[model samples]
Structure formats: C-alpha cells, structure tokens
Target chain A: MEELLAEVVNVLVVIVEACGAAVIIIGAVWAFARFAWVGFRQRTTAAFVPVRLTLGRFLALGLEFQLASDVLRTAVAPSWEELGQLAAVAAIRTALNYFLSKEIAEERRQVAAEQDHHEVTSTDHRGSGV
Target chain B: MSAVAEVTRLAALGTGLAAVVAGALALVVTRRPLPALAVLLDLLLAAGLLRLAGDPDWQGIVTAAAIVALRHLIGVGLRAGGRAWTGPRPPAASAQEKSAL
Candidate 1:
C-alpha cells in the first residue's frame, strides 16, 4: 500500500508541474495579446466590467452561499490546495472588480454633471446674445 | 493510461480549451479586452493550482506568483485602455479640422 501511495504521489507531482508550466505559458500569451491588439480593451470595459460589479454587489449573499458549498465540498473529500487557490482568485477578482467599478461610476457621474453645467451655461450665453 | 495520467491529460485539455475560448470570445465581444482577457489567465492559473493541490510542490507556488503578476499587469492595461476608449469624442468640427490639416 505504501508503494502504491508513493507511485500515485509521484504521478501527481508530475501532473502539477505540468499544469504550472502551462499556466505560465498562458499568462505570457495573454500579455502578448493585450499588447498586440488595437483597441480591444476599450470596448470590453464599457460593456462588461461595470456589469460585473453591479452583479457582484447584488451577489454578496450568493458569495456566502458559495463559501458554504466550498466548505462542504472540501470537507467531504479534501481534493487539493488548488481549490483554496481558486477561491483566493475568485475573492481577489471580485474585490478588485468592485473597486474598479466604483471608480468608473464616479468618473461617469462627474462627466455627466459637467455636461449638464456646460449646457446650462451655453443656454445662458445664448439668451444674453439674443 | 493510468488514472493519474488521464487526469493530467484532462487538465491539459481544459487549459487549452479555455485559452482558445477566452481569446476568441475576447476578440469578438469587446473593444477593451484587458479585463476579460484576465479571465483566460485565471482559468489557466486555476488549472495549475488544481493540479498542484494534488501534487503539492514548490513549483506550484512559483506558478501562483507568476499568475498573480500577470493579473496585475492586466489590471494596469485595463486602466490605460479604459482611459483611451472613454476619452471624449472630438466634436465633428475637429474631424473637419483634421481633414483640412
């Protein structure tokens, strides 16, 4: 039984190493695409990031629900540290997304307010000219 | 193939499929892709961490660090890209001015 355990362990080690290497390569490709593409980032943020944050704010309870599910899943059969890492990733992504969305909203509100101010001043100037 | 080997192969398949899908979707769906592109990176990182969890090694930790760095880079790109995309559209007169110049 010990021998069998060691064999599986060794295989898992190789598998993990393989996966890690692949992720590194994937990161590189992502970096490359972001740089190589023209104007790809512009369209994505307008449509998605805010949408993500708005959903995230509403999904707070759902997150707790997910945590409960994760705890149960891990408790039943301890899969690996990967699940923990994935959870970490999810948390970081969501938190960062929340902050970013807040910033974007702030900027939009400012711009809109300015536009309204500009319109009011322009109309006032026209009345004086007439 | 042994179960361990099969698992590894499956992980490989998953990573490849995710990269392709994410990249393609990013190209099709948005003008600003920095954030969505990060999803692809996350998927790859998840695969690595998942495998490492089973394997438990130093290399896995290193991989995680690299992935984080990439995520940061994407955040930076998104900031820059958002500014450019959202820059106020020049009034039509400016377009005519440029055409004259």
Candidate 2:
C-alpha cells in the first residue's frame, strides 16, 4: 500500500507539473501573438500594457500550479537528499510566486489609474467641446 | 525524469527567446526602454520558473534563485527610475499630447 501511494503521488506530481508547463506555453504564445498583432495594427500608439497584464496573470496562474506540484513532490520523497532538493526548489518558487503576485497587483492598479485619468480627460474635453 | 527535465529546459529556452522578441516589439511600440526592459525581465522570470519545474539539481536551483534575485533587483530599480524620470508631468501638456495623438 505504501508503494502504491508513492507511485500515485509521483504520477500526480508529473501531471501537475505538466499542467503548469502547459499554462506557461499557452500564455507565452498568446501574449506574443497579441503583441505582434497590436504592434503592427497601432504602431506607436498601441497600448501594450493590457497585453503585459494578461501575460502576467497567466504566469501567476502557472506559478501556482508549479508550486502545487512542488508540494505534492514532498509526499513521495523518501530520502533526505531528495527532500532537501525539493525544499530548496519550493523555497525559490514560493519567493517568485510572492513577487509575481505583488507585481500583478501593482500593475493592475496602475492600469486602472491610467484608464481613469484617460476617461476624466476625455470627459473634460467633451464638456469644453475640444 | 532526465528526459522530462531536458524537455522542460528546452521549453524554457524557447520561452526566453519569445520574451526577447516581445521585449523588442514593446520597445518599438512604446518608445520606452524601461518598460521594455520590464517586459523582457518578466517573461524571463516566467521562463526561469518553468525551468525550475521537474526534478532539478543544485545547479538548477541556484540558477533559478539567481534569476529571481536579478528580477527583484531590476524591478526595484525600474520603479525608482520611472518615478524619477516622469517626475510631475503637467496635466495640460499631457492632455494636449493625447489630443494630438
């Protein structure tokens, strides 16, 4: 039963890790495609902020999956050496996850502020018949 | 597991290359070097995290940690620089510029 549990957990780790990788790939591809399309369409006037924000959201989601897999790995790691490696890996990922989350929040706030400013200015212009 | 790691490493490389292209495109679109740098570093961070996935050795862990640290340092620098560089834009002038655009 112990052997069977370890095997199941090992499989679960691989699957979770794969999901994380898939999320990153999809996000990267989507972001690149949008960047290229918008760059060509609007040239210098384009707003790449939204694109970057989307990519950031996708990356954060992917990191969450990767961290989950790291936690799952501990379930099957029987050796001290393996556990040490897992711990180090998990620590790095956790740090990254925290930073990513913080940046995403900051960027989102900035984007919202910019939009608000834009709207207010446009409204003022309309009021003055500019 | 080695094969898995190799594949993931390769994927990470591809993601890094994509980041370079995206960063360059952002530079062209925004005409702002710092924002482009931020985009590049952000994507590279994603790539580094992806590389850290799967079974990695001490070397891999160290490299990922370095990438994360560099990302944090650069981010702080960019924020400071952005504030200093933009320092109090006149609202009327920016509105005129937007209108012109």
* Each candidate's DockQ: 0.09, 0.53
Per-residue error (Å), model 1, residue A83: 18
Q: In candidate 1 chain A, what residue range of length 10 has the lowest lDDT sum?
A: A58-67
- iRMS per model in Å: 9.2, 1.8
**Residue pairs clashing, model 1:** A40-B31, A40-B32, A40-B33, A41-B32, A41-B33, A42-B32, A43-B31, A43-B32, A44-B32
Instruction: Put down candidate 2 lDDT per residue, A23-120, tens digits, no spaces.
Output: 98788888878878887787653267788888888988888998899888888888999999998988887887788788879988887887899999
Model 2 lDDT, residue B92, Cα? 100
lDDT of 2: 0.84
lDDT of 1 at B8: 48
Per-prediction count of colliding residue pairs? Answer: 9, 0
RMSD of each: 11.7, 5.1
Local lDDT at B42 for model 2: 74
What are the TM-scores, per candidate, against the unseen true structure?
0.37, 0.88
**The CA-based lDDT of model 1 is what?**
0.49
Q: On a 0 to 100 scale, what is the lDDT of residue B101 in model 2?
A: 100
